[model samples]
Target: MSDFAIGLCGIGAMFVLMILRMPVGMAMLAVGYFGTVILNGTRSANALLLTETFSSASNYSLTVIPLFVLMGNIASAAGFSSRLYEAAFAWVGWLRGGLASASIVGCAAFSAVSGSSVATAVTIGRVALPEMKRFGYSDALSTGAVAAGGTLGFLIPPSTGFVIYAILTEESIGQLFMAGILPGLLLTAFFMGAIAFVTLRNPGAGPRGEFVPFEERFKALLRAMPLLLVIVVSIGGIYLGIFTPVEAAGVGAGMVALMAGISGNMNREQAVKAVSDTVRTTAMLYLIIIGASVLNPFLALTELPATLGETMTAAGFGPYGLLFLIVLAYLALGMFMDGLAMLVVTIPIFFPIVTAAGFDPIWFGVIAVIVIEMGMITPPVGLNVFVVKSVAEDVSMGTIFRGVLPFWFAMAACLLVIVVFPQIALLIPQAMFR
Candidate 1:
């Protein structure tokens, strides 16, 4: 009878649909749409649907999604990801536990261009896993590194999840992007350190190697010049006020396309595949946005966020405690849900509470993304695990699970770092916006 009752029941039904193996977006769209219609009657729902669809489809901020995705797809197809790995591997592959550390660095570089966990895991796994196996790396370290490293795709720039967060919260997309850079690099470092420690403790997981010849390493590094150049220009341009976020996205896509075309890597077939993938991914994102549109009215009507915020604030939790709870909830839900779908459903509810708790929107956006990274490696439905699983077929599921455990801990450490010193997350935005 009440709004909360309908909402809770609708969410419950959504879980049932998920258990039945319905697509997440479709289930949410169906449940949220039908629930809105029930709560507001058919007439209001239909009218709002028409209005919301038109406006949401044409929204300027929403356009950032397709551009970022296009940039990622083009960069990937152009062979930029491989170049990044080559450089990272040549330099780091000689260290103690070198190959595994190289994979983390490679994944971080690839994540700079491709924004999805699936793409990151698959791309790097295709390139790095075989090499790690060849180098006598343990399946645990090899598979685990790729899986955990793939989660970086969401943390690095051009991140689709970060873009979606901006759209949902109506935060500045530019600020959201700048917020990701430091944290992304820090997490990558954490993964590398964890790999080194594991290898050092038990050299069986990895093998130390002679340094790569400076000449060969430099040559290999040269192979990544295009990728490095593009990343530097795109992210730097955005940060320095030289380009808006949307414009920066466009430039990145164009650069990727040019590089792919010049290098003869992107044939007509590859181009088609890239476009098709981009279109499909873009459509799915927009549909989720539309589904949120259907629920937006209900969000307003419920007043649930206000009540919940008051409830939390009154229970003697400060901003930090409330933040801890929100992050924890994200971690738990991530176990079974897709990251994007989880964001779509939960953000509408908790984002308000987060803002009420006196956090900056830009800072909170970074924190939310870091939390999602933990999900991508968590068991059951961790998308990164699936990516590696699909690529490294000989690896059992347990190996991949064990592999990600350290990275998960590293992700937790990254979170703690961000929580303790908000400046790590806030500095870039403050320096830019101020």
Candidate 2:
């Protein structure tokens, strides 16, 4: 068979395995392994697999993944999440649909420190779910807000998605991270707006939160100050070159550990658990990266990405047209694959073509992360939705999905804003960094 034909066949077979419920990392590795053997020889394929695995594992950029995840886990264990919610609630919970709005805001705040969608969702899910329930907030609204809001974990700074993309595309990590801030805030605003609209539409949907006096609201600020500092240092520090992204992460980890310890949130046991969780989750992401490495070169040999790009170019589509197609693809895959898997699988194929298409790679990274954010809230396979679902047993999966629809629209709208105004994504990165 021709190389192109083999590549196409390999992709088709990979999807079949994925549909059969094979793990994404394994499916890619399996198809690419055999396909490499067919395209080359067994010896070449074996060497390719082994070398790819080793090189990918040793990549310095990827080290940021675990550090970022560790910072998040440490922060969560240290109880940053609870204080964030408390601060947000005290300030906004008095508004109509305030508690739900507060949940979105709280998640966005937490997303800065905790860049994992599932981490944000599950952490906030545990804290915010009960509060919403106690306040007589409808399960749909409460659960939906958490699921949808958790997606901000990707769109916000300190994103795992940005880390992977920066590594894969060789974009400056700082620039890509800066690119996400405006888009992230816009998304957060849309999420909050969606909640306000929904609860306003049906007054009973979100029960009013007990009013906190202005003094009490002001007092709540002290509890959330640590989070704001982390955001400034982790994100702002990186932006200003006060530290590298990884160094910023180290600072975040240290701050969380100290604060958590000081707050009595962390005992030795909790600290041990935090490390265990970080190591386990980081190992999983690394495994997926290693598996993708095994597959990418084999796939690269087929020249499928160039072929696809040429076809798109021949079809005479504009940049916007291609961007729309990419977003649509993410929406479909969001129903099946997890966000990181979707990114790792698709970036090798899409990155080259996207850059060649006159799109900015850093800009593309922001847009791509937002696409993953959408995936985090979409049905069937949204990790965030499941995170909230797992915690709120009384809320059915379908009901949660139904509720997140508004936030989904909100996500889409934010995406549109970014598409129309590349300046929104690029401005901060350029103005501050340049």
Candidate maximizing lDDT = 2
Residue by residue across 294-314, what tens digits does model 2's lDDT show?
A: 778878899887888788777
What tens digits encode model 1's per-residue C-alpha lDDT throughout 1-434? 88877777777888889789887767776776677688778887788878888888989877767877888888778778887888888898888788888888988888877778788888888988898888788998999999998888888887888888887888888888888999998999999989978997889899865578989899998989887888888889999999887888788888889889888988898899999999999998888788777665665666655666778889887888998888889999999988888887888888888888788888888888888889988888888888888898899898899988988998999899998899998899899989
Which pairs of residues collide in model 1?
none
Cα deviation in Å at residue 147, candidate 2? 0.4
Cα TM-score of candidate 2: 0.97
Go through the candidates in order and give the C-alpha RMSD of each one to the true structure.
1.4, 1.4
Query: How much lDDT does candidate 2 score?
Result: 0.85
Model 2: CA > 4 A from native = none
lDDT of 2 at 83: 87
- Model 2: pairs clashing at backbone N, Cα or C within 3 Å: none
lDDT of each: 0.84, 0.85
lDDT of 1: 0.84
